[model samples]
Target: MAYVIAKKKNTDEKPFDYLPKFHTLRDGTEVILDYYDNQDEEETYRILKDIVDDGQSYPQETMETIQEFKDYYLSHDAFVVRQAQTAEVLGAFYIKPNFPGRCSHLSNAGFIVKPSARRKGIARFMAQNYLYMARDLGYKASMFNLVFVNNEGSLKLWRDLGFVEIGRIPNAGNLKGVGFTDAVQFYYDFATLPQKQ
Candidate 1:
């Protein structure tokens, strides 16, 4: 018998990527969605820190330092959404391989919005951008491993975007004040998305 193994893939994440998007939110706030860069570090770190401190969404209790935040948030392809007028970072996200070797085609993502900027539709914008970016980065599918059951906003968003609940884990998180929380695993195949891009 002959065995042929698959080699790691280096996607055209740069040349064919970084397609910046501009949009107006419900309240007429102009936001620009673009590739993340060095200048975005501080604000992204702050946003992530706030999310971590909230203890309602993210898994971490605290990020500790910017360096630690970068290692987790910026290790793979990341993007940021900024307010066009002031250039303030509104939110950001990252897409990375969920597993190594043969499972590299499956990607995972994390997202956060400035606490003051929630309900402005930033999450929807990032979610839309993530699908295209993940596909462009050569991922076959995207999965969220620990979406807390109490995270109604995220649960609604993911479901609205057509993500399927593959499985549910009981008592998946110990939320700050919510005692034990269940979580649902979400999965979305890139091929299921419309190839408009």
Candidate 2:
């Protein structure tokens, strides 16, 4: 009798292999999307700090130092989208498991785009890339844990991208100058979603 052994697979490949290093926006601006690099830490931190300060989308406390921001990025599968020419960090996002143990198959993602970068399709581009990354990372589903109801743009974008409102937490978020608002949870199942050509 002959004995055969199977080879073990390498599971440490880059997570964002499906994404390109350079993507051209609708306005013809070339943007680079990749994992965060230490060299771009300052620029990335600036963008995140601005978002936290804006108080329009993300809910959070202040990041007093760059190290704090860097540590936050390192805690998740973080990526930055930047201007290829000027190397300006336009947007960034992080994807991670929604919970530990059996629920780990479900992933969650958060996004932040600079004020100058908004209304220019960056969010849509980042979201599309995020879904691809999530699928490639072996996540069965993706969810935006907290999409404020007052954020009509995001709610509309997520819906248009095939995400369904799975649940909602009433008065879960306090929008700046707008009192309390509901936080809607959106979900997308990879098996049901059509692959992007």
Candidate 3:
């Protein structure tokens, strides 16, 4: 089978030299997106750890140590979003290859927006930046392997951003109280990404 290769980033904490950029959320709040750094590590880990313990979205259930967080998130191209003025981290994400070698052009990403930052459009903003960054890193497409069906907000956001439902897995998410729940897979090709007007 034919495949594509994605440009490799330096195997360091910060893979790309991305300039901090400000974006307005749905409620007109401004947030800055930039590469992950050691300074922001503590706060970001707290956010992700909470989500993992909550058992609603992420697959990994526990992040017991900062090293575990590093091994999982920092191994790839990771970024964080913070409030422009206060510099309070509100969310973070990481883009990594979905497969090895020749299939590395197919990228995958995971996002975490703190509960307090929800409803302000932080996720969408991060997603927009992620798409461009993925393409810039030579990924031809991005695919989300598991999105719980009950996550209406994320489902809506991905669909609105032009991702299509490619497949579904029954009982894919072992949610906290709900037990096994249905999950959907989503896909997007950079080829069809509409140029921002």
Instruction: Please give the lDDT score at residue 187 for candidate 1.
Output: 96
| Per-residue lDDT over 106-163 for candidate 1, one digit per residue giving the tens place of the 0 to 100 score | 9999999998899989999899878888887789999899999888999999999999
Worst 10 residues of 1 by lDDT: 3-12
lDDT of each: 0.87, 0.79, 0.87
Candidate 3 C-alpha lDDT tens digits along 75-182: 778889998889889999988898878778999998999899998888988988888888887899999989998889999999999999999999998899989999
Model 3 regions lying over 4 Å from their true place: 1-18, 195-197
Question: Model 1 — TM-score against the truth?
Answer: 0.91
For each candidate in turn, the TM-score is: 0.91, 0.86, 0.89
Stretches off by above 4 angstroms in model 1 are 1-13
Error of 1 at 192 (Å): 1.2
Residue 39 accuracy (lDDT) in model 2: 75
Question: What is candidate 2's lDDT per residue for 1-197, written digit by digit as tens?
Answer: 64222222424446555554778888889998887666778887888888777666777757778878766655657788989989888988877777766787888877888888888788898898888788877889997778888889999999999999999999887777877888999999988756763
Q: Give Cα distance to truth, residue 91, candidate 2, Å.
A: 0.7
In model 2, where do residues sit more than 4 Å from their true spots?
A: 1-13, 195-197
Mark the 10 consecutive residues where model 2 has the least summed lDDT.
Answer: 2-11
List the pairs of residues colliding in candidate 1: none
